[model samples]
Target: MSRVRIFGIGSSSGDDQAGWLTIDALLAAGLQCDDAMVIEKLDRPGANLIPLLDNTAWVILVDAMQGSGPAGRIQRFDQKDWPRYTKGLSTHGFGVIDALSLARELGRLPSRIDLYRIEIGSANPGEQAGDDIQAAAQQLARCIAADLIATLLQA
Candidate 1:
């Protein structure tokens, strides 16, 4: 079984792509799948995200969030904090929180889940993420990498 599974969820629009960019940042920084961990980028997966949670011991979700704070500010949320942070985290009609709720209802949720929300300045179509958002993504990737390393060491 995978020790950890990280999913970067987002769309092609500007800042909304924060999640995907974070995933890219991780890859660029030399993080890769091994027996202990796996990473994937999901394009607005919505309800589709539920099945992907199965059997992972730990899960990390990365996504863009707006109105939560200043652009480029990153916030971390665990499963218990989802309801309070639901706003502006979704670029799709159905979002990460929705998927998690469904997973919980179905008893498919992992024992542990960590969500990283990258505050976005704009999610305009056909545009790339702003500099601040990109920097946040890179920063978040480093943080997650460190957390994973720590977890692996403990294991």
Candidate 2:
């Protein structure tokens, strides 16, 4: 099995900009089910992210966020520091951060996790996230993938 993994959750909100950009970035980077993944919602990102933790050493969650940043700004949240940065309302009932916090509170959280969020212009664009932000999200995706791959290769 591929060791590197990514779970991308974009909202059906924010004009869908973050969601589109995240999916585009993953596609542009050529990440796949075996090496990486781009998901639209965290609560239902399927079984892809959950099971991997059993055999993998790391997991990266990438998505879009509103408030406290400029467009195209990239943000990183470490597992330990996620709480301070992740308290807010998400269109997707309980966002990845919320779900994670729940898992952690219940003592079922992953041993290692990383979160990378790209500040988007907005989430709509119904069809796609436009050009510039899509590229930016893709950039974030590559960085996320590289980080995972690096960790695995090192081990």
lDDT of 1 by residue, 1-155 (tens): 88789989888899999999999999998999888788899998989999889989999999887775899989998877887778665677788899999999999999989998988888999999999999999999999999888988887
Candidate 1 global Cα RMSD: 1.2
Shift in Å, residue 27, candidate 2: 4.1
Model 1, residue 77: distance off in Å is 0.7
Candidate 1 stretches with Cα past 4 Å from truth are none
lDDT by candidate, in order shown: 0.89, 0.59
Tell me the lDDT of model 2 at 86.
66
lDDT, model 2, position 95: 65
Best by lDDT: 1
- The most accurate candidate by TM-score is 1
Residue 33 alpha-carbon offset, candidate 1, angstroms: 1.4
TM-score of each: 0.95, 0.72
